[model samples]
Target: MKAIVKGALAAGVLLIVGAGIVAGLRGSEPSAGPGGAPSSGPPRQRTLTIAAASDLKFALDELLKEFRAKHPGAQVQVTYGSSGNFLAQISNGAPFDLFLSADAAYPRKLAEQGLLSDDVFSYAVGRLVVWVPKGSPLPVEQRGMDALREPAAKRIAIANPQHAPYGRAAEAAMKSKGVYDAVKDKLVLGENIAQTAQFVQSGSADVGIIALSLALAPAMKDQGRYWEVPLDAYPRMEQGGAILKRAEDPELARQFRDFLLGAEGKALLERHGFFLPGE
Candidate 1:
């Protein structure tokens, strides 16, 4: 009886050891990742790069925060500049997953050139404003574009019309108000709408015709005041974007595009002073 009990105990110990050995072997093997590839550790994160208009600076920043929260494994990067300059870069084969232009025209041009992976979709309508720093004698809020004619408004700033849509819009607004000829000599050109705001903020220019979005941003909101330019003063600034044909991650880009055109995005844009597509 003693020998039988000893034999049973030995067998049980060997079985337990064998099971641990089997488990160890299985653990040592690499796991499969997305497409049945041997994964070393976690899944590789996806990257989405966007070329955006400078007018979207404040608004897009907020949108990206929400995007990252929802897609923990996705990484997003953005470059802001004149939409036309981005168009030129994209035409020349710049690597961007998406292009968010200040107007639909630039992206449509890309689509025409067969540079886009998808159709251009409008996201928002941009508004322009005549802005002046705090404590300025010019009553921009009272006189609107007429304030630019004041002798104290010697150095007026605007985005460069040659490449920036907002700049062209600013020029059009001034022209519509019959102030273009009076202030053309005093007009200082910024490379983009954001820089145009910066010019006035930094005292580089006395006043600026800049995006309403910037004027409402925390950075500039308290530093200055603005009077909205009438919608009829210039051509409509319908902002839009498209996925690039050379996008490394087209699916991810599409997801982001949907989000931008979604409810949350529209709310944030509206808060930042951008008008919605239908309104």
Candidate 2:
């Protein structure tokens, strides 16, 4: 009985020591947050992939610089190409979070597929121009698409109408100006507005039907001049932007979309030759 009592006393002491040790460890454990937030893990971050039209290269390059400055840790990747080309890729299941088209047609088509909401938003109205390199034989002061009908214009540059919204706009403007039939054979199609501008800038083609924003860029402004196509001549180039339904970061994509529609964004777009919607 004496041995059993001593054994019980020893066990009781061991239990007390173990309990104290557990209490000490518990005291050392980090306190719970008021709402159970992690106290030590790194902050969560998100990345967004945006596909924009090539004409937005200059403007978006500048704007994105500001966007990152505003969002220090947000990851944003932009892919630029013809709006139509971007649509084709998106239709093929490209993993894009957002798309800012150079025209509204593509976004409307996407919305029809239920890949986007029916509520499409117009962001900008692109201007079209006839641009020639620094010293091409083309008269810098010539007005209208009629310039393309000039006998000296043996080879005129244009983007592929079937794939570029701006190209389609250019074609429509040319038809409205009654110059398409005469200048059709002389057409040298480019892949996009940038490429069309390149055809003229490189002396490969006499003049290019290009986005006015591209023509007004620093280099082009210094080397070339353009006459705006009368808005009445062609359908408005109502550009639209929307977030994809399957975006990895739909919320972030929407944030960027709102940013693009904000007043500051409109000012930037105007500075780049994009007119306000309905202007």
RMSD of 1: 21.2
The lDDT, on a scale of 0 to 1, for candidate 1 is 0.83
The total number of steric clashes, by the backbone 3 Å criterion, in model 2 comes to 0
Model 2 residue 78 CA deviation (Å) reads: 1.0
- TM-score per candidate, in order? 0.87, 0.82
**Tens-digit lDDT track of model 2 for 175-237:** 998988888888877666766666677666788888888887765788876778888888888
Clashing pairs in 2: none
Q: List the residue pairs that clash in candidate 1.
A: none
lDDT of each: 0.83, 0.74
- The clash count for each model shown is 0, 0
